[model samples]
Target: MANFPLNRRQLIGGMTAGALAPAVLRAHSRGSAGRAVVVGAGVFGVWTAKALMDAGLHVTLMDANGPANARASSAGESRMTRGAYGPDEIYTRMALASLSDWKALSVSAELPLFHAHGVLFFFHEEIDYFRQSLEVHHRLGLPTEELTPEQMAARYPMIDYDGVAVGLFEPEFGAIMARRSVQTLVAQMVLGGLDYRRGKASPLTMPRGPSPLGAVRLDDGSQIEGDIMVYALGPWMPQGFPDILDRKIVTSRQEVFFFAPPAGSDDFSPAKMPGWADFDAGGLHYGFPDLEARGAKICFDNHGPEVDPDTNPRQVTKEGLAEIIAYRDRRFPKLRGAPLLETRVCQYENSSNGDYLIDRHPGYTNVTMVGAGSGHGFKMGPEVGRLAARVALGEDLGEPRFTLATKGTTQARSVI
Candidate 1:
């Protein structure tokens, strides 16, 4: 039998136990000074809610499946985080700021969510993106080293660096336990006085006309008015606002595999190995060093075909499995036929241009909608939340790329 991950019951129980603080589930207190309602409790929504609440707003956070829902793109076990966004230093700077936030939140929660195991970038030839990334890293004074093929071969024997021109290694950048971290943040905030509701909410409507922000229409026929509303629903944006997001946001299936290392072998252990990204001749592949003896995590970054979050089947295709195995054989020679530990089928919310969409709704000034993670937005969530909150309060983000005007129906992924 495949080594299964935590069942639904176990995950929920563990989350509840981990969240030791009492949270108010009530919504729309008439006496509250300022009220804000945020939909979708994934990474974006959770963090925005936390930021709003921290700013002394009585915030109501509603999600259909709560934080880290299995169907959500942010529901994965781990996500890689680094400061290199090709030559784009905006994201690199944002990443540095977000990393500080991640560490701070983890410290506050008493959970080791951000693991700084370092990230290794692999290249088989002259890859412009890799070169540009290195330039940005060097310019920012971030710690990075160019490893010769021979050096990489000696340091990481597991990688098949054949025909590789060079490898760039960024020290102290690593992966975060996505689900646990999301759960921990929202959980801790809930314990610290965040009002979290396990319910679905819609933003296209309002109960009163004074402010277009209006009231959120709940699935249960209840209305909760808020001074501001934020929709960070990820893949569900198309479902809720088909007219607006059907063309702007695209959701695609992403498959991941974890292969157990050879028995008792320390080769792939976190202490010895670093997380790797292979932008090689064949394709783009990435994997993390074994953590907690959970084997190396591997996945392809290509945005798979578009998919619907609610209806698409969440299982890996046999062809997909074969393609992944081929990478294993070429990359980690020792783990070619290792036991398949667990499988996860997740999705990515892609904006047309692959940049995060963080703008107020075109029609409703009081409502802000965010989506298009483009498979790499997890690490930026901390900063995104604070930015979205700022936008709702009429603060200029100074980021033209995140505006809705840049988002379109045509898909061309340029952001790395």
Candidate 2:
């Protein structure tokens, strides 16, 4: 793992040699053919479309509310890009691959989108998950450190680790600007001659023969045809294909809050504090340092009630705010009464068992349905998009965890 620096001018110099060349070569390969129509312009859809374009295909991207809109799950200030999966090595690898692409894109964009402040995990009782994760990290040669409670207290003295049993630090991981990165990818692709449109799209009809999906109907009574079609609709999966995904994937309401630190205090900034995750008995709470002075970001990981992404009000609740404030007060006494700077309400399109659903539509071989971010999918967007593109182009990833058949109807949430 490369510990990429956050300096805007040194972004390119921070990357490992030849880090960006493979992705660029893969994109411009002459292996894939025909036209591709992708629905949804979120991180997943955008990356999949980019992958298709790189594979030498004519690709058209459509979005209902534009890229990373307020309603989309990818719309947020920042998202953590860490490799801690509590023993799930597959996701850890996926996150690492995605991180490379993120770093490459970050340097190419106007601003360095990835902030390399590192990530800290504060564990509670039962250290089995942490131990197994440490083993995987060591085996993979990832730079990870096991810190004692005393070490954590010495390094991050601003936060009070009352009941924290141990800490795991990954110095190479940090945060990725969410909305900005997605929009940047879309713009870069569009500037490179990729077709991007703002419209609502749905399959014209279920494929009943060996022929591929003919076309998709748009909201304005228009239609877009393609030899390969991908539906990476984030939260809209259940609504778009209710008959198959209604029970397989679910949408949950999630609340995020940003608290303003004390004036003239750099204690909560990225330079001083790393992005941290607390595995307490109550629930998993994670947050980032004050990057771009947008306050300290915090959110609980427990999935909220199921919601309809289309009609659900994007508003934080009083109760949710109270809960986070209480946690903040306990963890960081200095921020006990910090003013609330901002709040965002989003949705998580979670698949059962917390794994992604990247597979071909059972009714149509030419169409691939990709989604089920399950809250932690944002950081894995680049790799997910690439896998979705491969599946759309008639190649199998051979990873059953991502196959539709492996997705249970009940939400077990085995993956973090």
Candidate 3:
């Protein structure tokens, strides 16, 4: 394990970001402190709550299972952070911007929330996403080192590079402590005077008056009202605000498995191996370097069957389990029979296209809706939160692609 504790100088820099705040937070800081109610304690919700609180707003953050609940999409050990979005430079830059904020938050908290161990994408010749990513990375000046199969085998012998035709190593891309980071952010915000509540958010109840705003009713029969209400319920978005997100957002069941490495196997450690994604697989399957002798984390990223977040059984299906074992055997032959350490079934809020849905509810301007992480949105939490906070504060982010109108009923996935 590496110690990325904040140094004195880095602490000063991060502290200055607090005084000046980020551009998005600064925009809201100009106004008087407004009372806002934020539903959900996932990455997007926490970051949005923190941004609003930082901008001098009194925020009441509510969640069913507290911060980074096991049921939440953001509750995971490690999340990949990469700028290789194929042709989507929008997310590429937004990811970089979010990384800056993550580093700053790590400094402020003095904890290593992000690990820049780099990410390797291996692909076969027919994989068009590889070339598309290279074009975007090259245009954005993101550093990458191309590798041949032989080169990859010479470097990472653990990975079976049989079908790997082209390899790209992005040194700046890395992984973040997803669940820990979200919990830590929420704790810090609470300590910084945010009102953290524990309860599931019910539908918004509109007051019978000329006012455009409404109060968020909790499952506890408690009504929490605010000048602005942000519904960032992640997969629960479609369930809570059906009319707005009915066909626009879908929640899918995702499965992840951790395998015990070979006895005395330091080869799978982060120092030796970086995070890797094998596009050569039939679908997207990514891995994190072994973490502290626990296990090697591997998960398939292709959208799974649509599920209801509230009632669906959150367990890996036998078919999905067998498929992952087969994938592991094919991609990493050395860890074929490793003991299964753990299996986690998570719900991912996905859009028809993988782009996030961040826009105001057409009926209410003050109630900003944020979600549809689509599995790839966790790394950009800070930027997304900034945008959400701005919108909740009544600013037009002007991002048409993220608007609800752009989301469709058909599941023609494009952006990764």
Evaluated with lDDT, which candidate comes out highest?
2
Residue 196 local lDDT, model 1: 86
Residue 46 displacement (Å), model 3: 0.7
Q: After best superposition, candidate 1 residue 297: deviation in angstroms? A: 1.2
Model 3 off-target regions past 4 Å? 1-32, 107-111, 205-211
Candidates' C-alpha lDDT: 0.79, 0.85, 0.80
| Reference-based lDDT, residue 384, model 2 | 86
Ranking by TM-score: 2, 1, 3
**Candidate 1 per-residue C-alpha lDDT over 279-364 given as tens digits, one digit per residue, 9 for 90 to 100:** 87667888898876777888988889888898868888898889999888877888988898988899989998788988877777
The CA root-mean-square deviation of candidate 1, after full C-alpha superposition on the true structure, stands at 8.8
Q: Candidate 3: which pairs clash?
A: none
Better model by lDDT: candidate 1 vs candidate 3: 3
Task: State TM-scores per candidate.
Answer: 0.89, 0.91, 0.89
Candidate 3 residue lDDT tens string, 1-416: 12224332332112223332233244446664667889999999998888788766789999988788887899878888888887787887777667777777666776678777889988877467778778877765667788899998998899998777889898876788889899888888888899998887776533343344557877778788777888889988887876657878888888889999898778888888889988865877898988756599988887888888767687788998898899999889889998999888887788998889888777764678999999899999987887787777666666798898899988888987
Global Cα lDDT for candidate 2: 0.85
The per-prediction CA RMSD against the true structure, in angstroms, equals 8.8, 5.7, 5.3
Q: Which run of 10 residues does model 3 get worst, by summed lDDT? A: 8-17
Between candidates 1 and 2, the one scoring higher on TM-score is: 2
